[model samples]
Target: MVTLVYLSVIILAWFATAANADIQVVCANKSVSITWEISADLVPYAARLFLGSCMPSHLNLLPSGKGEVQFNYGFENCKFKKQIKGKQMSYQNEITFRPYPKSKPAAFVYPIKCVYRSPANLNNQFLNPGSVSEGRGSLVFHMALLNEQLTGLATTNVIPLGSFMPIWAQVEQKSHQPLLLLMEECVAAHTPQLHSGSWVYPIINNKGCLLESKQGNSIFLPRYHSSALILYLQSFRLGHEGEVYIHCKLTAWDPDVLDESNKVCHYVKETERWSLLDDPFQSSICNCCDSTCKSRSKRQAEQESRGLRHNFVLGPLIVVEPDSPAK
Candidate 1:
């Protein structure tokens, strides 16, 4: 009877210690720091603790017999994953520890994340005079093909055929009212200039719907802001060789108003239905994705008069097969 009571006491103490573990994270412009305070009972297993495949950089034993571990890494290190969502860039990693040496899975896991404002300037060297449209008292629009991190333009023009390509488009609202950016239509072409003889593949069509998403994993990611959008397109081979260019018609519209003509939609494979990325409640606007999506005559004229629409091109991207050598 005494042995059973002692065993219960030990079990309760272990649970209490595990519940007291705490973690804190600090994010900076280019680096991140994570500090974890481990309970005294778990200090013996500290060697097995990891933060996203990275062992703690510094560990200190406290007077209370507890352990404090610190993890310091740059934004690009420690296997930290980056995500852009609603004007914020989030860096995510996990704190995990295995209670036993042979454990196949982590016995304890705590997710840690830090968020910062998305960089204002992506520093795209590809932006040319033609890419910007600034009518007197009108919004300025910019578009570029972003790198995998969404931090800047792709460093290289070569991409694996099946890999995801990131395209970012944003609007500099200036003094104008809040506006949302939308890709009305996008196409992949063999040449920078579109001629009658050019080979073209449609991506986003039917006004603002992502057509490739119906057949592929391509889709519009969540917006960094109402004024900024990112499209993750699965690369495809365009005629086996040279550079592929992406041409898109971008539109800026009132954020409060979303119509069949001014919205972003993508097909979700799981639900087998088209979904609106910005506002799902009004996803009914996406039903037109299957058929013709006509623009409101009056709205079209207004957009044209206000110079709220423009065309942008991004590319020279080379798509190669899985085993092909990098260019």
Candidate 2:
């Protein structure tokens, strides 16, 4: 009887271990990957497992009769939902398994989440309220060419013509009332410094209108916050070679107030109209985009003086023809 009891205990331990599922996850800048391991006892049910309505990208059968499945998908794909809370951006999804088609509920369910820092929160100095006004009472500003994932700076300076380029601009507004950032005007030139006779290309004109949107797929993406903006520009080659520089006039304004002179407007080809990114209901203010955007009156300028405006340069980006040889 004592020998039989020892054998029964061992059998129970093995069953417990086999019943538990092992899961691992890897989060990349643009995609998320999950690996689910199925024990030998549950290998038959592998077909029923799923990650947020997506099937396994790869499946392997182990020598030990166990099975492994991987799910890979982009953050915006696979029905993943996104949420922005304060300085954090989070993506959420779930893993589930159904034993039968007629089942009332999933037999297994596991919640999963991926979180990233907001583009405006990437700088550590912005976290400190006192540091924003430490010197000259000027706010800190940043602009960079982001990678395809929009998570960090681009690793390469080379860009293919007609490809979408992500440009991020942000301002530190710590300890101050909420503010909005706008690209009043932007231009592309061959040199970082503008001279009297330098040739230029207009990207954004008429105060805050994005002229490129009317010609190409370039437009402003949904803002993560009022203090930051992202421009998705369709790349273009200048002079057939060399480096290109982008010069932009950035303005910080009151969030509660958006007028024709202090707004970001992009043309919507589908609607055939200019739409204000901040407040679409106020898009009527964007009608002047096709003609001439009026300058701010003296009283309006004085009211906006509480905020700040500055010029920022981003560049040295090399745009090459698509048929050119790889660098």
Candidate 3:
């Protein structure tokens, strides 16, 4: 009877200790911050927590007698993967913290729910049947200019002329039904070179029509799969000046197929609208120029030469205690 009572006490103590260990995960910028608070009672037994595979890159542990510790892991180094949906980019990965040398039960493992949203001012279009689209499946389109240096950063509404602008277009299918698909892209003046799984054609039509490979329009997207087109172009035409409008149109069709029940016949026609300006595009900062471009440049140089520079040192300023020499 005494042994049974002692066993019950041990089981209860284990459960209590497990329940007290708390972990909190938060999205810090592009990285994830994982913090675990060890229960005071278990501090003596708690060792360093091991990340996945017990690799040195994932090892983060609390110092001796410390009750809490944090581990900040970059998205690339961690096991988590990134996903893109519409205008949002999210992380789909799990962080597992295991007790070193193995424990009675498993350690804490949880997924990090973090989403990075793109700017809301993108040129997005949703076409319905009879409007520009004729299909049972919902057709969606979006266009934006991505930063050359930082691919994840996007510029909206305006692009600079004469620059090799990187344009990103997204096409999503909301319906599960199979359908015959035809996709086409047309610029106002010169055709931009598209880079994707699909091909591009020189012939562009203002009226909505499916340009099949037989008919010369070679770009086609198969049904049931979403498509993303990365196009590049340098518009130096007559309308390449400041505040000039640049327009692009995308059209698709779903003609009647043999399998009527499996395929939903429809048509989609959408336009991606933006402007081409002479002012250079800058990500993470607003570009505000003076009335005259030449005047702004001259003033910018003068301000830089006369501006005061504040020399400052950035640091957390850590001090390490001296340890005794090992005998």
Candidate 4:
């Protein structure tokens, strides 16, 4: 009886400690914040953040703002493996947007393209082998949220932190392939040159089939176009050696817009929940300009030198603390 009681106590303690595992919250500005623990009892999705604990809670929330719109994203490093003996596996790729699209009782949706890979799982379609997708990959979906699924970008606030999502994937046999997905804020720039798995599309038809909105909101069209990326992983076997560029194109829509600045990276603190960083497309502050394009019409006038496309005037390399615990 004493042994049973001790075991129970130990189990309870283990559970308590497991909650709120350590996580590094990074902002685009290259700032680092630490999230030591999370709890399902108090916070629900705490367990899902840890790659070590592969429970059913498969969601990574990226908070946007309070409006309805079709968020296109994919994960970069999502892996799967059979436990000991091989077991059937299914997974979910979900996104938890912030402010919950505070609109009507409509449907909200986020799509995922599951590229199933086996020892021979070379296809980008469903993992079940026999499953058939349109082209290179199989696209699945998670929970449908509000009525914002079909609409274009609308009037919204900055997506708060704590938002998350999941990608649902399954396989007949047991094999684990880390996943890589991202959400494209726009769809127009998705081209062969755009190395990212997702895209940011221009005004198009009902691919996402966005919903219609009312007058209270602005025209809802974003001038500085933006897309979201759902990075399901940190790394993958690209079968090659190159950079995986995660680029976002901003469309400054206003005709009178002047300050077309760019932000390389920034820090996101735990306290600043809805932190906003600058866009990364502008020239790096580290590099300098030259007179190379002296005569080009679109080039910067000699008087206002914005040298080398990657002018080395950049700030010091961002230093981040190691995420893992004591080895």
lDDT (Cα, tens digit) per residue for candidate 1, span 1-327: 895575445446655665666778887766688889876765665777887756888989999998898988764445566555656867677888754454477666788788878555542343455343344346677876677977666767788888999887887877887778889999999888998887799999988999999989997874556788889999998776657899998888888778898889888774577777766556789999999887767857776677888888887888888788987
Backbone steric clashes in candidate 4, count: 112
Q: What is candidate 4's TM-score against the reference?
A: 0.15
- Give the lDDT of residue 267 in candidate 2: 88
Weakest lDDT window of 10 consecutive positions for candidate 2: 127-136
Pick by lDDT: 1 or 4, better one: 1
TM-score of each: 0.61, 0.60, 0.34, 0.15
Compose the digit string of candidate 2's lDDT tens values, residues 45-82.
Answer: 56667776666778889998878988988654454655
Q: Rank all candidate structures by their lDDT, best first, as comma-separated numbers.
A: 1, 2, 3, 4
Clashes of 2: 0
- lDDT of each prediction vs. the true structure? 0.76, 0.76, 0.36, 0.22
Error of 2 at 108 (Å): 39
Off by over 4 Å in 2: 1-136, 299-307, 323-327
Residues forming the 10-long window of minimal summed lDDT in candidate 4 = 308-317
Please give, for residues 1-327, the per-residue lDDT of candidate 4 as tens digits. Answer: 895575445446545654343333322111112233332232332332222111222233334311111222111112211111122122223222121233532121222222222222212222332321121122231111111322222122111122211111221111313221111121223232554474433221111111111111111211111111111111211223122222222211111211222111111122211111122122222021111111223432331232111100101111122342321
Q: What value does the lDDT take at residue 11 in candidate 3?
A: 42
* lDDT for 265 (candidate 3): 15
Off by over 4 Å in 3: 1-15, 39-64, 81-92, 97-107, 115-144, 147-167, 172-327
Error of 4 at 282 (Å): 25
